[model samples]
Target: MSDSIVSLHEPGRAVLPAYVRALEAGWSPNTMRDVAPEQLAAIAADPDAFLFGLNGRGGKIRLHDGSEVDRLPGIIRWIIAARGPESQFVGSINLRWQEDASGKPITELPPHVLGHVGYTILPDHAGRGYASAALAAVLGEARTIGLPFVRITCDADNAASRRIIEKNGGRFVESFVAPFYGPGERLMYRIDLQS
Candidate 1:
């Protein structure tokens, strides 16, 4: 299956039956929360608004706990689409990082965040290399935006994710427990785009 990443803001109505299906199956694009009825209703009412809000284009970010945080430096989200006669949404990926009032991307992540890149593949879509391809594609987007590099993090025990990160030129940086993420060590890696 050929895979492509589509920005959530792109115009035109794209069928998202797969997204609905995933939601019905108890999947959430935000790993922090499940598919809430209210969120579902909002998405159903106006998907583009929901998606644009997710991109955090100069808007406050609402966390899973109902608190809002100031928008980070630069953030964007994309749906991983499997293209064919019937296009399907397979997963979601996003890039976020520290930024200054001048709107420049800073490589360091805020304390509340673990990494610059975060992604989730629907359970059914795992093991098909979608994660790797999507991450690589998003790195191109990151490069285009003038980011010198991106830091990605995964659970230290998640070998599959580590492989995907390393396959895309990620170099091991360090491992530490993120205070905001509870316990357990998380491995951090950096992929330099300057090369």
Candidate 2:
């Protein structure tokens, strides 16, 4: 199986066709609420805006249950996994940076944000190990940012995501109910970057 090259999203220079393809194929970001007709048109018309809007500085975030809530404080880095340099976009990965009082990166996450890393690949690109490969690449970024470890979470029933995290050396921490996310219990995994 082929792996993807993960990099930060570049506006005018990055792959725009991939976003178009994803939109045409009806692929939405993992945390996006249902894309309305106007929103879809806007995305197609201006992908840069759509892509940049995924940045974490915003005040609101869409939950897994398709509801919106105030976002937590953290630095969010949006990334793309592509076939190669400037190639088709295979998927996306988001890394949230949390720091302690001393300004050191921390593994713990806030209530609104479930994990340190979140990712999603288009349906057509699923099952090709892209998620794992993308995650491994993102971990390099985490290391560059001086994170000691990262907390990753996924739906309890998502075996594929569990495997992806484990493939990247993630160890199960515990399962917990997110106060902001209603009844669904989420599984948490920790990947130590110091090792």
Candidate 3:
């Protein structure tokens, strides 16, 4: 478990020494069946390497040893350092978007948007509103960056996950079956930043 303060910055060499031992708490969550946390050092070395196949969002999810990490499809992960003498990282939120409506590929980004609420807090960090706080902070960044909306998703059976989405002003969009990574059905949520 990490005990250092949380700071938002590009993952540098500073990340290796930060999360090498974070195996137990996040690797195997209380409810999630197929996710695992990664060794911090490995992720810091290769930020893009963490992104796995699409869980939703038509993109991909970052994974370290089967657990999910926040991925930045827009910018890079603005590493959130925990606040305290405790060497803990709450969660990472990123600003990015899906490939344009046409898969033909375009150079410029689409409409106004900052980061998507990529992933929430690890299992051990749940119940403290860290997920909410991290989400709020991400929305704030979108506002500062002048975006119109943000999107997020969670498993349908995950009550805690639904709460996190709702707490951040997420509206129930629709529940659908995920194709790529499937242990079960996933619930997708959306929030209009302008609303």
Report lDDT (CA) for all predictions: 0.73, 0.70, 0.52
Stretches > 4 Å off in candidate 2:
1-13, 35-86, 100-104
Q: The CA-based lDDT of model 1 is what? A: 0.73
TM-score between model 1 and native: 0.84
Q: Which of the numbered candidates is closest to the native, going by highest TM-score?
A: 1
> lDDT score of model 3?
0.52
RMSD per candidate (Å) reads 3.1, 4.1, 7.9
For model 2, what is the alpha-carbon lDDT of residue 112? 70
Number of residue pairs clashing in candidate 2, backbone atoms closer than 3 angstroms, sequence gap of 3 or more or interchain:
0
Candidate 1's C-alpha runs over 4 A off are 1-12, 35-38, 73-75, 81-85
**Any residue pairs clashing in model 1, and if so which?**
none
Best by lDDT: 1
For model 1, how does the per-residue alpha-carbon lDDT over 102-189 read when each residue is reduced to its tens digit?
Answer: 9777787767777788888888878877788888887887887788999999999999999999999999999999766668898999
**Every model's TM-score:** 0.84, 0.75, 0.59
Kindly provide the TM-score of model 3 when superposed on the true structure, using C-alpha atoms: 0.59
